[model samples]
Target: MHRSLLAGTFLLLFTTAASLAAAGSSTGLDDEIEGESRPAPSSQIPLPQEGDKPEAENGEPPEGNVTRPDTREETPIPDVLYDISALPEPVQRMRKLLMDAARSGDIENLRPLIGTGANRTQMALGGLEGDPIEFLREISGDDEGQEILAILLEVLEAGFVHLDEGTERELYVWPYFFSVPLEELTPAQKVELFKLVTAGDYEEMRTFGAYIFYRTAITPDGEWLFFVAGD
Candidate 1:
């Protein structure tokens, strides 16, 4: 009877120990699964917003993302005058005299207005060799100088510019192109210029970097300063 009782006690002890071990193992497995499924903490870092774009080292907006504005300055065009009635009395008188002489078609009529030594109208940049009238005739495309006379009339009829106002060098210059940049001329202005020069002549002047063609200048006091060509 004592042996049977001891056997029953051993069996009960083994079964209780086995149950406790299985419960402990199940609790450990549950803890492992919970650790893997739990979400991360709310204190973690966040991603950048759409407006938070990065800049260049020079403080400019990044190249591909922005377009910079053009800050270069443009050249100003000069004012062109077409009316002779707006000129001073002396200037108007001289212009009328030149027009009359040019219309006469007699190159000699220009002589008296051209005046004598020292006050004579300048016909060339470098001084003329002999008589001014004869020199004009020589340079004329035809024998009678009609072409030159026509040119003179055409030059006076074109638009003019008044420069050096209030100064000793003040004068009225013909064919306003003399004071304007070739590159800056408008299409209409270019057409007006074509009336005075051939397309080839315009291209040559552009290459030379200035309007080196025939241009006339008269002083504010009615003196015909020059009717010449060249730089």
Candidate 2:
């Protein structure tokens, strides 16, 4: 599989008015990142050419595999999420439960289910690299962790490209604007991509910094191995 170049590391700057009190909470208006406009044309990761691309290019899944219930049927492929229904039912169930644990910041809930294949919690948040639960508590410190968890789940569930299928772990990828060299996209496409990620603080990441999408690695049985940001 091709590795995306926009892999990035973020120095999480969290300043919230309250803790992550509820399992289902929003980052509140004042707490959310302000995404007024796209970042300056500075970061520079080039994209693949048009023709020599994978047969499944962010629009639709390959046929023959469309007999499942959750198949898109006649739907447009979303820019961030993949049609995970294409996966086995057990995987689908596990993925949902895993994301729920993340959304709620219930690390204890996820600990028992973590697969042995992926022990490095080195995917998101720059490098709170340790046990995934510890990584959550370290980054969130409260309910504020919910946003980080939500961001991760959003990316994992919606990544546009299914990079490859593996025996133990499956990989997914997305074109996070921060991961892409901002300068590489046409001004308009940058704006569109930024809008998709809810919001961000790209103005602070200009110069040599590159924002990245989370490359989520999960087991067929629904274990989240790693979910790191990449450029």
Candidate 3:
């Protein structure tokens, strides 16, 4: 009975040893297959660079995009003024008066001087006063207004160039209505007259002129401005 038990124990030990050996061999085969199928490490893969980046199939920059210059250019404006002497005498006269009125703030006497011809009627003042410069801006309307302005500009240029030196003379070409003598105005007043004559025929000029003069004062420049407007 002892001998039979020893033999059975030996057989069991052998079977166990064989099973362990087969498992070791199967494990080694699985490891080899896994190593062959696995992908390479991330560091080994190729990557794109800025210069090497792929472009659109059509070769244009991507959709909804455009390129522009870094700097912008400025446009130039045109010169509009013509020679001063080329304008008519009446235009020249009106330009002078408008500028004169501007500097003086003389409106009361400026009204009757508006409109063409000796039989001219008074225009609506539109209730402006105190500042004839502002009035000159108002009375002159549109291109017609521009004519007055251009003329004034010409006269201004002329006065500055030709009459620049010597005694500053005020040209008294007679008032239209009252037979009052042309008063020798203060230098300040003379400057006002210069502005009135040159500020152009803006609507504000008329209103301001009327307000300043109210009754006695006359704009020697207004009639000529009106005549220029007609032409």
Candidate 4:
């Protein structure tokens, strides 16, 4: 009986201690949850009224007010520009004949012009040479001639000519004769030729310095003289 009473007493003490410990743990957990649930000090702060607020430092809109719109104005872009095409039959034919003659060094196209007169022959023959200034003189003389010549010289002085040699006779004319012959030019000579061909601060080789290429060359064959003009 005594042992049973002691055992019961011990059991009751243990239960009481366990209940107290569980209550303490529950209280601690509740305190932690309450502390976490409380609002942050910064978040609890009140926003100032518009009228009461201080002026912005930079005098700019607030960060919240700035936003990019879904649409914006765009600049209109231009299309690739090409030169006015030379289309009139006479001009076209003349241009074609001139190009062909320049390429082949053949004056067959100037046959009709030869019958016109000495002046016409001189002018037309000048066109046969690769000088754009001379061509302008043939086409339109005087002030216009001077203006075009100036423009031509400017372009020649600065611009590099990229001649495309192809089966196309008209285009091939440019490459066929526009360049100084490789056999006639040393490496340094070739560089000099390129420099004169592509001269200045501007685009084309219209400058006063390009006349050397337009001069004539008498081939060793007395029967066949080559015009140094185009080449």
Candidate 5:
């Protein structure tokens, strides 16, 4: 009986050790897989946000520019801005206002771009689909949100270059899965895309196989609607 008890004890200890080993192995393997194909984290990295600046009454040079999201890792592209001059003056004005608010991460500043109370209407805000104020809070609180804001700003400023697998047409456009819908991504792109987009969008895209980024939709009348990113 004592021998049998000792044998049981040894088996339990061996099983526990094996379970731990399996867990560790699987964890390491997962990390390795994630590190290999995780959307390459866009081209740029994040920069820290700045504290509020004193108002620039009149044409004062304003406060020192907040260090925008760092582009240290991004391959340099030509500094060409899209021509919004042909757009209606109001659209131009609203776009400018929205760009400024996003760049500064100023929630109050977004008021002018968004409509007034009761009449206040913004079509959409985030990848997960939330309100503008909540969107502001989100980007304000998180570095990745800031990065998303920066990407939107850059796309607005200069048109984005669409990038697809094995394409050399690398225009000055924001990278996107060319032609293919977000819902139809191949197995490899799908794996790389898992954590890149919101879970809601990801699941939807998985069904659709095509994903679009830097999407800004305004009403035909020039009302600022929504801007969404990722898969």
Candidate 6:
């Protein structure tokens, strides 16, 4: 009976050991399956910093990133004057001389009024090399200086402006367009301008940013300062 009891005790101990080993194996299998089914954590991407510019395909700054500047200038328009009777006596006299010479149809008549030495009327910006009258003829469309005479007459007849008032550099410029901004011209003022230049010429001047046509300037003391074209 003691021997039978010992054998039964050994069998019971063996069965309990087997059950514990099976439970541990099942638990380990479940843990491995769960790990495989779970989703992975995503990697993060960093954002660009402020003021950092993206490079173009050519390695330069992107065209959209650059800012361009406006180069056009804003100029004030001066008053236009039609009647020259209110102008100074010397200024009036000089205008009369220019008018009479132009009306006479004789380009040579302008010789005396053009003066001599340092005070000569500036016919060209760089100074005249040959005969002034011959130069005038060459510049005229007709080759006889008739066109130049006509131009002078038209310029003097148009409105003018008294600029730099009270200063030694004061001048009375013809057509008044020299001192007035082209963009600021009124419809009536444009009509006055049309008398001197064609619509095509006006458009060209506008594109050029300022009038670059032939303009006359006379000093306050009746000296003809310049009668030339260009900027």
lDDT of 3 at 65: 8
Each candidate structure's TM-score, on Cα atoms with residue i matched to residue i, is 0.65, 0.46, 0.21, 0.21, 0.37, 0.66
Q: Relative to the true structure, how large is the alpha-carbon lDDT of every model?
A: 0.55, 0.38, 0.26, 0.24, 0.35, 0.56
The TM-score obtained by model 1 is 0.65
For candidate 1, the 10 contiguous residues with the lowest summed lDDT are 39-48
- Candidate order by lDDT, decreasing, is 6, 1, 2, 5, 3, 4
lDDT tens digits, residues 1-231, model 3? 112322222122112222222332222211111111211001011111233211122221222101110112332211223354643465456555656653443443344344322223211111111232223333332212342343333334322111101322111121111111124334553454344332232233344332121111112222331111110
**Best prediction by TM-score:** 6
Model 3, stretches more than 4 Å misplaced?
A: 1-79, 116-231
Error of 2 at 72 (Å): 31
Per-residue lDDT over 102-149 for candidate 5, one digit per residue giving the tens place of the 0 to 100 score:
688545565566553222332211011124444333322232345445
Cα lDDT tens digits, model 4, 108-194, are 333442222111222111112233222333222232333223222322222122122231111111111133333443565444444
Kindly indicate the candidate among 5 and 6 with the higher TM-score: 6
Of 3 and 4, the candidate ranking higher by lDDT: 3
* Ranking 3 against 6 by lDDT, winner: 6
Query: In angstroms, how far off is 78's CA in candidate 1?
Result: 3.8
Residues 3-112, candidate 1, lDDT per residue (tens digit)? 22222222221122222223222222111111112111111011112432222222222222111111124634447999889998888888888888899999898877
